[model samples]
Target chain A: DAGITQSPRHKVTETGTPVTLRCHQTENHRYMYWYRQDPGHGLRLIHYSYGVKDTDKGEVSDGYSVSRSKTEDFLLTLESATSSQTSVYFCAISDSYGTRGYNEQFFGPGTRLTVL
Target chain B: SQQGEEDPQALSIQEGENATMNCSYKTSINNLQWYRQNSGRGLVHLILIRSNEREKHSGRLRVTLDTSKKSSSLLITASRAADTASYFCAQPGTGTGNQFYFGTGTSLTVIP
Candidate 1:
C-alpha cells in the first residue's frame, strides 16, 4: 500500500448503473494502472495512465473507461455496470517510465464491486 | 497470447519445506516479476529478475529467469504458514510494453 489509496472499498450496485472508483497516490509516480481480479482469471489490466491525461486501454478495457486529470489521482468508470463486471479492482503505481526496465509496482488495498 | 502463465495451479506444502513455482511466457521480455497476494488483499511485489540475469535473490526468495526457454521460476526457502497466498508473475505487454500482463497465479498453501 505504498501511499496508494482506493476509495469506496466496497460497493454493490445494480446492473445499468454508472460507477466510478478512485485511486489516489502520494508518491506521484509516473505510471498508474487499473486492474480487475476474478477467480480463475487472476488479474486483468483494465486501463493504465502514463502521465496526467494520458491513458490507454488494456486487455479488458471494453465496457470500462479511465481518466487521469492530475498526477496523483486516477479514476476508473463503468458507464453501465453489468453483473459480469463484478470483481475486485486494484490500483497500482510505478516509478519507472520506460519499458526496458521497471521498478517494482506498489498496489492499493483494492475495491470490491458487485453488480446484481 | 503474450501473457505470462504460472504452472502448478495449486501447491500444498508443510512449513520449513521449500516451494517452487514456475512461469512461462509466449514472447520476449525485458524482465519478469513475482508478486504475492494474501487472501482478500492487493498484490505485493516479491522479486524481479532481468532477462540478462540468470538468477536473483532477495531475502528468502530466489528468482531465476531463462530467456532461451521464455520461462522463469520462483523458489521460496523455509516455507511458513504466512507464505500461504496466491503468486502471480507479470511481464510487459507485447505492444506498447508500458502495460503488464499478469498470470492467473498459483495458489500456495503452507501447512503449519
Candidate 2:
C-alpha cells in the first residue's frame, strides 16, 4: 500500500508502434524500478531510477527505455513495440536498498500491454 | 549476479491446513525477503530473515533461513482462501547498490 499507481492498466498496440507506461507514486521514495513479468520468466527488471533524471538499465533492458523527470513519476517506453514485448509491467518503490540491513519494496497495481 | 529459484512452482492446499514454500538462491547472502501477489494486484511484503537468524515469525507466517544450503522456506499456518496468491523471494544482487534478484515464484491456491 505504498500509494503507487500505474496508468494504462490495459493496452493493445500494433507492432512497430511506440508505447509508454507511466508509474506515479505519492510517497517520496528514493528509488523506483520497472519490471516485466512473463509466463515462465517471472519478473525481469527492465529499468530503474535512483533519483530524478538518473536511471540505469536492468537485466532485460533491450528494446526498452526509461526516464524520470521528478521524484514521483517513472516512465517506461518501448521505442518500437514488438510481439515479444507484450507482458505485464510493474513499478516498485523503496526507501532504501536495505543497504545497511533490510528494506521493503512497494509495488503498483501493474499494467498489461499487448502487441499484435 | 545472484538469482533465487522457488520449488514446486504451484501448490494447492485446503483451508486451515499449512502451506510451505521453498526458495533456493545461487549465491549466499546476508538477508532474504518474501512478497505476496494477489492475482492482478501488486505484490505485498510478507517477511524478512537475515543470515544470522535460523527462524523468524510474523503472525501466521514463519520464515527459516539456512545459509549453509543457501535456501529459505516460508510456512503459513492455518491457511485461508484469502491466502491464494503467488509468493516470491528476493535477495540482494551482485552490485553494492539497491539491486535485488527475485525468484520465479510459487503460486498457491487455498481451497475453500
Candidate 3:
C-alpha cells in the first residue's frame, strides 16, 4: 500500500482503444500481480510476474496482457478496450522468501479505468 | 470463481463493541489471511494464520482459522468509528498457482 503506486489513478477511454496501466513499487518485491475489482465481485487476479521477463496468466486473463521488463515496474495493457474491461485495477507486490508462496502481498492504491 | 464467501455481507456496531466476520473457502489451503480496506483505498494486510495454527492476534485484531471446516473469522475488539471499512479474507487456492483467491468481503460500520 505504501510502497506500491499505480499511475493515472483515473482514466476514461473509448471502446476499441488501447490502454496501459502502470504499476511501480519501491519495495523491490519479487512478485508483482495485476487484479481487477468490480461490484459484487472481489478482486480477481489477471496476471502476475515472479521476476523480470517472467510472467504468467491468472484466472481472468482473457483481455489483459502484462509485461515486467524491470523489477520495479509491471504494466497491464488492454489490447482493445471494451466496456466490460472498465474496472478498478490494483498492483500488488510480495517479498519472496525461501519458502515459496508464503509471503504476503502489498497492494497499490489502484487505478480506476472507465471504458466508454 | 471466488474461493471464499463471507457471511453477514454488512455489519453495524457501536463504538467499543466487538465485531466479527466469517469467511468460508471452497478448498484446502496452506494459509488464510485477513485484510482491511477503507473507502477508495488499497487492502492492508491485517493478519495471516497458517493451516496448522488455529488462532492469532495483533493488538485489537484477532484471527481464527478452522482448517477442518475450511473457514476463518476476524474479530475486532474495542472498535472505533475509524474501523468502518470493508474486510476481506483471502487464501491461496488448492494448486501450485501463486494467485490468492478473495471473498466477496464484509462491509463493517462502526457507528460512534
**Candidate 3: fnat, from 0 to 1?**
0.65
Can you write out model 3's per-residue Cα lDDT over A2-109, one digit (the tens) per residue?
Answer: 688899899999999999999999997888899898877888889988889999888799999999899999999999999999999999887764555486778999
- Residues A1-116 of candidate 1 have per-residue lDDT tens digits of 89999999999999999999999999979889999999888899989998999999888999999999999999999999999999999999888646755677789999999999
Q: Estimate each model's TM-score.
A: 0.95, 0.95, 0.95
- How high is the lDDT of residue B3 in model 1? 62
Order of quality (DockQ) = 1, 3, 2
**Model 1 over residues B1-112: C-alpha lDDT tens digits?**
4567888999999999999999998778888889999998899988888878999999999999999999899999999999999999998765442677888899999999
Q: What is the Cα-based lDDT of residue A71 in candidate 3?
A: 97
TM-score of chain B of 3: 0.94
> Candidate 2 — which pairs collide?
none
Write one digit per residue (lDDT tens) for candidate 2, span A3-113.
999999999999999999999999999889999998766788888888999898889999999999999999999999999999999999987745566667889999999
DockQ measured for candidate 1: 0.68
What local distance difference test score does each model get? 0.90, 0.89, 0.89
The reply for model 3, stretches above 4 Å from the true place, is A99-101, B93-97
Chain A TM-score, cand. 3 = 0.95
Which window of 10 residues has the lowest lDDT sum in candidate 2 chain B?
B92-101
